[model samples]
Target: MIIPILYTFYLSFFDWNLIAPTKEFVGLKNYIEVFTDPVNQKVILNTLIYIIFLVILNFVIPYFISLIVKFFISKMQGTYKVLFFIPSLFSLVVGAMIFTWILNPVSGPLAYILKAIGLTMPNWSNSGILAITVICLITNWKVFGYNFILLLTGLGSIPKNIIDAARIDGIPKWRLVWNVILPMNRGIAIYVLILTIVQGLQYVFTPINVITTGGPYYGSSNVIYQTYLNAFVLYKTGTSSALAITTFLIFLILLFLEIKFVESRDKDYV
Candidate 1:
């Protein structure tokens, strides 16, 4: 990892196509191009959108569902967990192909069901927002189970004595969860948040590649997809390296902010 990262950084300062015999040092040129390129701006925007969708669908929804299963439906929790986790066991390529067929506007069961209800399905593969939405939903569906399992473990780790004390103190169930459980699960919550942010683009990559290939336009493209296009498709190694470095820096900053924020909040809670 260190070697490749150093190599990529070294490449970012040069003009080198994959076929070139020798690299030409073009210091800052690749970085400048990456910043000035309009397509890169679109890629960044799409990545941000992907992160937002991932937080909502993958993190928030699954966390709440896990809480419900842990507390409200304890008797069937094991069964529900197994069912939810089944999707995550499928390989990403297989999952993407499965969803592609399921959401096919022509012959997919989803389209057929909608048509039976006198409604039309949108062009999920060709349209911009729709394409991104479909990919995000598939990603969420595949990963939600894993996240739920993590959160369930977090919830389980809380001491039953504390919960009993809260109950004896006449705290409502929701209040106990909000006031005691959530704060106690801060470590796992932060872990999940970081995972979502760092792997957000990667989670959707396979689906986008299989289902849209960055789409009717560049609608579904994220920074990772753009990097792949630059290095492999276009053979622009320097630009791809620059893009990768830029993305890494962005995530580094985000990770720093998240850690600082969570630490401060944890201190306050203490």
Candidate 2:
């Protein structure tokens, strides 16, 4: 696996078609072209915006949801956890397909409900930012339950003694969470951040391919979609490899920053 990835980096620098008689070295042309190409620029910007949205949805929203679920979980048996977590068990493809139907312009449940209320809903995959935002919304909804479960497990690790100490110290509920629970769970936060960011990059692809297919004028396509389109649709293997390599580099940098942040925070925790 590592060798293949390393080879991708080497191949990305060249203009080598898979069927060509001679592989030609193009230096940094592919990388340079990535930045200069209008479509590639749009994909990169769209991907960055998607990442920002997902980080908030995956890490921040899930943490609060877990806090809410924790309150209920303490009073009940494990039944509530099971019920809330059922969605996480379904395949991403299945979940995206289901949501696509719900968001369909004509026959979707949401559209039907809006019509009944004397409202007209625009097509979800409409031109411009609306398409990308809809894709982000669907991605967030599908991954939210699983993230909540992760945070719930982290919450469960908090000691009863600590909660009692905070209570005895006259700490307010919000203050207790802010000053105690959040700091104590910082490691979990960093872990979730890294995992979510990495997975978030790849997870948007299913929805983009299925719901939009880069439709409504390529509004929702990300780097991964571009790579797929290049390789399979356009048969531009060299350019596809370039896009793939760029995706890998972007994620690698993100992973590195996350590791550095996590290690620094761990020292502070120590």
Write down the RMSD of all candidates, one decimal each. Answer: 2.6, 2.4
lDDT per residue for candidate 2 within 4-72, as digits (tens), equals: 888877777778657778778888888887889888888888888878888888888888878766653
Which candidate's TM-score is highest?
Answer: 1
| lDDT of candidates 1 onward, in order | 0.87, 0.79
Model 2, residue 52: distance off in Å is 1.9
Highest lDDT among the candidates is held by which one? 1
Per residue, candidate 1 scores C-alpha lDDT tens digits across 1-270 of 899999999999988889979999999999998878888888888888898988998899989988888877877778888999999888888888888888888899999999999999887777878888888888887888888889999899889999999999999999998999998888778878778777767878888888788876798999898898899988999999999999889888878877786777667768
Model 2, runs deviating above 4 Å: 71-73, 261-270
TM-score of each: 0.91, 0.90
The number of clashing residue pairs in each candidate reads 0, 0
Which portions of model 1 miss their true places by more than 4 Å?
Answer: 254-270
